[model samples]
Target: MLIQALTPADKSPLLALARRIADAGCNLSESRVSTIGTEVSLMLLASGAWDALAKLETALTKLARDESLRLVHYRTGQRGNSAQLPYLVEVVAADRPGIVARIVEFFAQHEISVEQLNSTRYRAMQTGAEMFQAQFTIGIPADIHIAALRDDFLELCDGMNLDAIMDPVKF
Candidate 1:
């Protein structure tokens, strides 16, 4: 199940919320939390029975109302075996908007699945230039030729002035 919550930037409330979910008989399988300015958002993947999910819904409703947390939840079905290989993509460039969007667009156009992504903006130590960087775990279908894909991707990256790399995720 996928659960999303927007809550105040405080520790106790989040701990209380976690307790509520545990008390409702749900196990938190995975979770990510990020804070932007004053507010924090959380995404949690939880597993539980149908009845437990219902109970959790009720509890979360009350928690949201009382603590002013915005909570939404839904059960997530498995996507089945992807039959695709995992590749890691990393990109760095002068800070500019749309860099991430363009990369994602390329993957989308190629019908690739993005399993995970992390991106950040920072000042470069060498040149003090604002830099944007992103890392992605992408799923590539079996039929595609990886060498051809790398060639095309590097060409595009060069055109955009982005230092980029794509390699298989090694064990």
Candidate 2:
């Protein structure tokens, strides 16, 4: 099952949530936690027997009501193996609106699937200049011409004055 929770940043219920999952005989398989602005967000995947999962659902419900957390959960299946190659794309540029949208659109046009993306905007400590940085983990179809794709991606970044790099993910 996949669970998501959102609460005020100052009130972290990570330990409580983990404890409940364990008490319900569930194994946490994956999790992502982040603080965005004033809210803390959590995404967790847990696996267990059907009865245990039902127990977890009940526990989570009570916890949500007691803690006033925004929570959602649903059952999900495992991901199948893919034939695409994993690549990482990184970009750093002057802070501007639409940068992420433009990059995502570029990949979408080529039928590339973005597995994960993390981006941030901050001021440079040295120069106080606003900057934007983004990292994308994408799956590129094996049949795609890498050389031509790289050239095209670089060309797009160059046009926007964004420094970028595209490289295969190494284990």
Candidate 3:
């Protein structure tokens, strides 16, 4: 099952949620928790027998009501094995709009799948200049020509005055 919760940022809520999942006889398979602005967002994947899952659902409902959380949950299946190779793409450049959109478009045009992406803008400490950085985990089809793809990607980045690298993930 997949569970997502959003609540006012607090240190205790995560532990409380985890405890409830455990107490309900569910095993947490994966989780992502982040503090965005003043809210804490949680995404969790839990696995167990049907009864345990049902118990977890009940527990989650009670917890949400008690703690005033915005919650969403649903049953989900696991990802199928893929024949694509994993690669990491990193970009760094002066902060500007549409950079992420352009990068995503490039990968989409090549039929590559972006499995994960994280991007942030911040002021550089040294010069107090605004900077943008992004990291993408992409799945490249086995039949794609790696060198050609890298070349095209670099060309695009160069055109935008961005520093970028695309390399195979190591383990």
Candidate 4:
């Protein structure tokens, strides 16, 4: 468990902290962020025992203090069960807002749980339009219909002028 106090107006510091956490060889478990007036609080969970992660914890605390943020707590091993789904979905399209919302909504409607989601934006070769790529690792129940999901995503791609590729997650 890691605690950080920040302000939404100072997002750079928070993001920098997140990056540092990643560099510290700890897997981020969960992040809960809330804002009140000009202050924001972030509660993060990472993998590792307190003693084992002491150096990292101290560094994070120092960084937080330097940024005028508060260090709340430092602990470890706090996370929920992850989905055991067997497939992944990759979607690429022109950069635009609401893409993630729509994709998540689609998955929700189908009762598919997202296990991991990573997205990036880059320049497209053809049109130079900002291209957005999202890779979703999801958990599909054994009883769920794959054909329906494929068809729905296909139709969605058609409507959005994007490309969606479904791939099986290899064990």
lDDT of 4 at 11: 58
lDDT of 3 by residue, 26-128 (tens): 9999998878778888899999999999999998887777556888888899888979999999999999999999999999999999988888889999999
lDDT of 4 by residue, 1-171 (tens): 565556555553667667767777666677866665676767676665555467567767668665466566656454546544578889998899999999899889888888778788999888888999989898887787788878888899889888888878987
C-alpha lDDT of all candidate models, in order: 0.85, 0.94, 0.91, 0.74
What lDDT is reached at residue 58 by model 4?
A: 70
Please, what is the TM-score per model? 0.87, 0.92, 0.91, 0.57
Q: After superposition, how far is residue 166 of candidate 4 from its true place, in Å?
A: 1.2
Provide the lowest-lDDT 10-residue window in model 4: 76-85
**RMSD vs true structure, all candidates:** 2.1, 1.5, 1.6, 7.2
Among residues 3 or more apart in sequence or in different chains, the pairs in candidate 4 whose N, CA or C atoms overlap within 3 Å are: 1-75
The candidate maximizing TM-score is: 2
State how far residue 91 of model 2 sits from its true place (Å): 0.7
* Error of model 2, residue 47, in angstroms: 1.3
Which candidate has the highest lDDT of all? Answer: 2
Model 3 quality (TM-score): 0.91
